[model samples]
Target chain A: MPACPKCQGLIQETDAFCGHCGNPLAATDPDRREDVFDVLTPTLAYYFITLLLLGIYKLTSVFPEGFEGIIVITAIDVAIVIAFWGNYFQSLRPLFSLRGLSLKVMAFTIVGAMVGSVVVSVVAKWINLSIQDDVFYSTYMFQDTAYPFLFSTLFIAVQPAIFEEVAFRGFLFDNLLKVTPGKSTVYVTGFVFAIIHLNIISLLWLVPLGLALGFLRGRYNTLWYGMVAHFTYNFSLTVFEFLSWF
Target chain B: METSSVDSSAETLACENCQAVNSATQKFCSQCSFPIGGTKNEQIAFRSNIAVRTRMLKESERHVSICKKLLYFLAGINLLLGLYFGFAADDFPSMISSICVALLFLILTAWADRNPFGAILTAFIVYLTLNVVNIIDNPALLSRGIPSKIICTVLFVGGIRSARQVTLQREALEKLKAPGIGNR
Candidate 1:
């Protein structure tokens, strides 16, 4: 009649460790939680390697130019199109709970992003730092190429809304908790998530974003909270860029 | 280190809730079914497994992009050779060969439109064709080489960069669709 405390799976009263999750249940001790700093280094390093390999492959080819670059970049637009489909899967994915989504979570996500961005904006202002010169529009390529408003919208909004949420919130945050038991995982995972951006200049802003996303992930137990927040963050930038306000 | 020391002792001492004992090595509480310890190592092993599977998935998605790039590189080479023969041979046969290479390049481009790497190769072939055209116009076209070289450099570098992003995004999307297995 006992439920396995580890996974909430049904387990016989005679079992010591959870047969399903392998969690040690007999010991009257606190569960050992692996620090996020410990697990993060490898994951972040792997991410760097991924970026390096991708950059090398991208820079070496001879292809899109003039109007062609637009076409090729539009190929990236394919990701946003798929992001639309991800919405459907989000509801159906059993592991991800949608029930936690409430008005409070939505408000928290927006407030978190806004607060994070404002802090970042202030820090950059304090340091007299400039926005990354050639990041969005790379210098070597896409110089004359205009990233159209629509494409930019897709790039900023849907792409990060889906991908970053899935990676930082849904995957990393969830997985880290298995090692580092307890609610404190939200903080540890947040720090690691910020580090993965690998842009120190934006670290101040990114850290809060990480914290907010992690909070939402834990609070709602749903990936949608993070996704919605990420979308809002990106969409704000898009609006700022559109208005030439930044 | 101190925290872990404190944690282990606390677990051994705390008896707020009673659960059936399984064994010293056993991880689960027999009656209450609560995990007692050693969750970190287990999660690491599980995540490592996930990482390996994700790597395999990524490699599979990259297969198409790798093929397209190689094809593009080959098309560029063929187009260049055909152009060289056209000028050196100075005959109708040479011109026909050049035209044939150009036609082949076009076919490759059409095929590549749906593929990222193919598009890049097609662009290179076009850039080379421009050079071939210039050479045909001036048999001794050494002076115009500098300008042609610049165009080729831009086309080649820019095309690949664009294609790579496109392919990466495609792969990311594909990965997101595939459900995480073994978690259940």
Candidate 2:
């Protein structure tokens, strides 16, 4: 015999409810409880931290240059990913399992990324022709230096591919599926992903990209395929820019 | 102590815990001090009655109150916007629509406590219709329209959850009232 957790009344192992207090014993069941860093918690934490960092960026003006600001923000995002998922490494292991990471899905994601990139570029061009502003191009264009191509590949392509996938697909996507039912989880996650970018002009492209990534993550149940797709999209942009295709 | 009985031929009730025979009118057993004559079904029914009362109280105090507050808040915002557009901006069509929608939301809020499902359904229909008309009139409202659509989706989902809960509560109450059910 053991004491009930709520009222400390004597209870038998077979009992489903406390005899003395009549409290349901199901609340004490381990399977019913969720971890502190569930999907919603991390998603919310990411936004709260990002907003706080944005406020700091505005107030302090510590990183005056745009590139430096991006780097600092990316660093903060990485820190958030680590802080939230660090303790629950065991639970996250199943999300990255080898059985779920199929080569077919990987190839599909790569093709999807290529098609998505082309579509985005065409849309961006059309919008640019109408507006004649080239907001994205002017914002992301790096100075033509000796190592400009390498710099773009490292920071713009690889860094975001790894870090963003880890945060969105690996951490947030996996946890969201646990809480939400059906394909809506993917859409909701994508919505949050796009909103965090905080750029109205980019939303036109980012939202679709996010949805595609979310779909892949849910379909394959692994983050690696998403990383490949994201990397290819970013790297292709860098290559296209180097070739003066845009 | 003297061994006395109300009557030798009178009915005797047994205690559930100790099985001690006692008078039918006695509430507790003399031997075990446990409540007599109350069967397990009666206890279950008693507990369910308490649960139903508590759930009803909670639904009214928390869920319904929250829905009413949110409706009123949205109504207040719309009213302020209507006044601004009517007086300051001088946009008559927009102002009139805003005022009408505001009044509708306020009425829905007042009705929510009595008829939650109706209020929620009406509010959703009115809001969606208004937004659809406004969007048709001005396509440029698309940028601002997405956020409102998202909010309405959330409200719709909340309404669905509330409806499910109310349905479950109503079913439980009906079961409690059924003859020969949970009667021991």
Candidate 3:
């Protein structure tokens, strides 16, 4: 039976479209879109409590000065990654039973990252004239940094590719498909993905990325495809940053 | 269209308003939005979806709450450790760094409460800003680039995971309260 992408409502197998929501029922693979509220709330709550405590400490003269900010940021990043590792592996268990699919999905994620990054960079330059940022095409952040090559590669190439795909493609995309009424689910999820970046300049870059990723996931019916594409896009950025071409 | 009357017994099942023939097992009028007599099949289907979605959300929420508490505790410990190291080793930067680290984490947790995605983005921005500041200001830390890189890598990996976990739990919870599942 064909299913509605939005609400996961089943339709007749031979139906041209979903009767419940009127979405075209040509495809068999279901879309999965993650919910932002589900992903952000508890962490935000804890972060808030911690911030309050830090505020008091600063007021009382216990606040660390100079390089201490780096330490705190580093630790928070560590905590978040640990959580990602746990979830990523847990989610992967089911796919372990299907080794080929798993490999394909992983490859797909990397490719997606590369493509996304190239697209972002190109669009960034094209619209550079449209935005007003003294730091728009700076060689400073990438050039002056002692290990621009390493950090950019690691941050851009490795981390974002994996986590973003897991969050957006693996989880958000799937859940979104279950809630929406029709094909509107795809657009809604894509829009949410774009907005998540929280940068007006990034809106243009992200929306297309969202649509492309959504389409790839739906086309392949595998999370790995999105992941590979995401990875590729990011890896390319890392390389570009390394070469200082940007 | 003609107002045609159906043989009630022959059709066996029919809509009250539209009088359209339906199956004995069908629970809804295809033409008009009406209850198909007294069968509870649709009700059971509706309830099951709600129950499943609800259960998933609640389960994820509990996990998220625990993770949040854990992060807070970790921040506290890091802060205390910084104080101890500051006095013992007389390395003010190390001490400050530890305390600042705790503070940043706290900020992230707080920001996350209001906006989860914002918390992650801010965390990244904060980290990058702090590192850049340190690289410019602290010659000693700058000279120790390898160690800094290692530290960055470790934290980056860990942060991404924790961020993912927080988000996963949130997503599950949202699904629980989503529309359509519980709607009549």
Candidate 4:
């Protein structure tokens, strides 16, 4: 006896509809999803809300100018994520688990991220001869009366390390796993991560870094590994920026 | 060509329309679902359902094509606007900025041509983000290009609706393409 593809109710070989479910024997495909959007509707919706809010703030001039602005915006981001996070909590919960955490691989991830950050920055600067990144840093990053470096570490490194890993590695990567092969999942999520940052110049290095982060999450089955790696990478760059490497 | 006079008592049956064979217990033909073993009324109902679905697929495809043109128009407008600004203001960076944006739209347009549902949504998100950056960077900029901006936003919203239509149509078509699942 075969089964209905959609309802899974057993049916006789010659039956057009399942005996129990009466569903037409048509629609026998197991999974109907064909495109990236097919699998990523929910995840994209969550991402869209955040981006839309940011745009709304800019257009309205309601967003503040400095640290207060950053805090408020970050707060809204967190709230938006939390709102969406409730629905996906069950699906995303596994990413937070710490099973199979190997000390050796963790150590390598941290070291590799640190070393890779230097190469990325240097190569990025080389690729664009006049990499006027100072404008970007001055415009968006830790501005203020004092403790700019500390704020830089917090905002630039720690925040993205923890939060971004949750979004891209946690939500987006996991969503891709169902539709794509394992390695493709890493590559696709990496590409998406880089593009979302909206910096065309930074895409050269950001893409690889996104791939690295995706690899860590998928391999370890936990976001902790990726978070630590992301923090190390971003923190090293933060330190380098203060040291005037650019 | 439909031969719905399938014999219920026979061990094997052949489809009335396509002539594909099926088991007597099967109410629909295996290859074409021609109601090889069903009564006259059942066969009519099955075909009516299929006809309705086929009509929907055709409608959705038409809608997707219209939305795709909107994306192409957006790309051309961005290229023209960016070049105008770059030349008028004599700022290379500003010029590069719009050119890059134009390129992104062109790429997105191509992607939409292939996969309208997912690709168009991606474009819609990026389009909004760019405008947000523009408004934040210079509030005056929004006031400067009111008509074009409004038109672009309308196109994006329309494109998104068309993408939803594509999503629904593709799902229905997939069922027919699946093995052992002839037209519903």
Candidate 5:
């Protein structure tokens, strides 16, 4: 005797239907097919939203000047993501979990950020010289300000560190990891992060920085370390700009 | 001897379709004429056949979904380009045609999500026909139409593959719903 594939009822060897449930046992066997949509839906949703926002920013003349624009855009981005993926946020709670941060981890994050800042600065200097173009900073906005140092540091460094880390390393990277293979997840997320910036000149540096941040997020299984690194990178540049070192 | 005879008769095959009992030696049910078997080997073979067909149907559905998603992305791109060309281009006829084709692709994309085989086939035919007419009207479009033709070719092949799988799955389902077999 054979068991029915659907109702699990025992039937004669040549029987096509289940005796108990009257189900077509041969046709109703379980389908174990895996669809990528399970992963693609959220990932694509995030990217599509981001692209749509970028398009709006390009086309519209409604945005405010200077740091206000950045704040408005970041706020909108956060709001859109929260609204779009409200249900999924609960599952992503682990990525944002700050409970496990130890003294050792804190020290590592600080030291790593400092070291990464120096290395990136050196590389950026060389690239800037080779390309014969400025490092594409928005320091011009602060040039005529009452507090150039404070404003630039706040706008260029802290804002991106908090908002971008939450968006890219925290949300986008985690969602991408679900769909992508373990080895390629970091690289793919990094590429997307760099591309989203839409700066060909800064791409050379942004790509590696994105990769480093992605690596930190994956290795430590948290977003704080990447945020610290990002802040350090941007803060270091701001400090140099204030001191006129570059 | 009586107990042993009763136990032997209890081993008689039952019809899955009609629940009619038949003797162990019978090849088919007496009440419903449904097929029945006695050997363990036949039971295993039947189970394996069902498993294989089920797996094939699932795999086909997955492929169709993946292809449909790709087509949706392409359609979106086409729509954007059509909008840009429609508003900005000086060539009135070409711009209108481009917008119409893009709208058609968008409809096909939505349709593909539901009926991939039919939608893909229709898109393939429409694209091919349009390209042929354009080329006959103005041979200059040969250069411009190459990409469209290639895309249609790919869509046509994908549609054929999806259609074949859908047909196979439908046939299997029909077999399950035949006179003696119940619907799953």
Candidate 6:
């Protein structure tokens, strides 16, 4: 009749190991209410590495000029995308389903991304103005090119759209479902997504952008909508980023 | 990190939580670290203890990260100021050194996640060394940014404290892994 204190699995006095969980049965300590952290380690490690890489990328300015720099940056993003699908191939395969995806959802999500980007742009401008820092925007490889819009959209909008969705909505959000209940999972994923961007100044818009992407992925149960939204958002900002140079 | 689904079978092992099913050859769930076949309460308790330690380590990580962000901002400012002054005199040494220092801070910020205490301690030493060198060059240098300098010093000191906590938490977690841990 005595229960194992550890996992609450039933154990007979004669059995040394718990039949349910296989834990060794022990006497003495009363069962205390237990809590759970509710995450698998690999996912946590991925997020941690992502933050470190993004932070280092932000602070270090030693990349070769122009398009070469874009190649270097995008290489890391591509590798991360590979890792996301490689490590969790079976788990992430489900997010690729088009069950709830529709033209209306894609259109709505794209509109949301555009509106979100504008809000972010305005908030970013306000922050720059208020801080009086002039907020150096590094054009990097996107500068002085014959095809600034092409390079920016390819390197910035398209690449990040695919990569970020896979990393966050596909890998992280799916994994988070194992830990958290349905309601808060999206926002939690969004919060983590925002933090990884490493731009405190744009957090006002970044958080919203993150939430919108999370919502798209969560609502429709597909990465395509989120990808469309993400691409739209970044592409819109790419326009804004290049607007002043001309 | 690899997770594969297994159809329910007599030969397969199951995890209590996380829903991870493992082959009979596996002793723990690869995805969740849950023990397989048979587990002891002590193992669960041990993982729980480790989870707590991991949380503590993350809080410390947040501290060093803030310190890292502060370094980022200061390094940018230093690089800009160095270029400005160096350009006025056409002296490239200060500019080169400033860039080197900025790069060093960036590397330290990346390393901070892995070893918060060591990275922050090294960063603190470098920061203090820079301030001392500047003060020696011109005693009046201290007067210009006293408030800002004080804030940086306080934040660095707090970062160091958090790094120490990280070390302690890590050690405790390591001890929990020693042989006879779950046996006890």
Model 5 chain B: ten consecutive residues of lowest lDDT: B1-10
Q: Residue by residue across B94-141, what tens digits does model 5's lDDT show? A: 565566566656876786665565466445544544444445456688
TM-score, second chain, candidate 5: 0.65
Tell me how much of the true interface, by contacts, candidate 6 captures.
Answer: 0.00
Query: Over the stretch A4-105, how does candidate 4's per-residue lDDT look in tens digits?
Result: 676675455655444333355654442343554566677767666766665555446577866777678778877766676676689888877777788999
- Determine which window of 10 residues in candidate 5 chain A has minimal summed lDDT: A128-137
On the 0 to 100 scale, the lDDT of residue B181 in model 5 is 31
For lDDT, the strongest prediction is: 4
Q: Assess the local accuracy of residue B129 in candidate 3 as a C-alpha lDDT between 0 and 100.
A: 39
Ranking the candidates on TM-score from highest down gives 4, 2, 5, 6, 1, 3
Model 2 per-residue lDDT tens digits across residues B1-184: 2122223576876545444455566543433233344566755665566476556735734554565666887799889999999999999867866776687688777766666654654455445444544454465886785876797657654663564356445534332322222222
Please write out the lDDT profile of model 6 over residues B1-184, one tens digit for every residue.
Answer: 2244343454766555444455565444433345554358856775676676677778987886788788787678777867875888677767766766676577667766665555565566557656655554566787898898899988887786776555555544433333222222
Q: Candidate 6 at residue A84, lDDT?
A: 68
TM-score for candidate 1, residues paired by index? 0.41
Predicted complex 6: CAPRI docking category: incorrect
- Model 3, B4-86: lDDT tens per residue? 22224534466553454544444443333234553476545534655665665556545445445545765787689899989
lDDT of 6: 0.63
Comparing 5 and 6 by DockQ, which wins?
A: 5
CA shift of A150, model 3, Å: 3.2
- Give the whole-model CA lDDT for all candidates, comma-separated: 0.51, 0.60, 0.50, 0.67, 0.61, 0.63
- Model 5 Cα displacement at A59 (Å)? 8.1
CA error at residue A243 for candidate 5, angstroms: 1.9
lDDT of 5 by residue, A1-246 (tens): 576566565566655444444455454333324343455457656665675565455435566755566567767876876664465667667877888877787677777777766766677677655212423335666667788788778777887787677767766676656534444567656756765554445556776888888888888888788877788878877776666564
TM-score of each: 0.41, 0.55, 0.41, 0.71, 0.51, 0.48
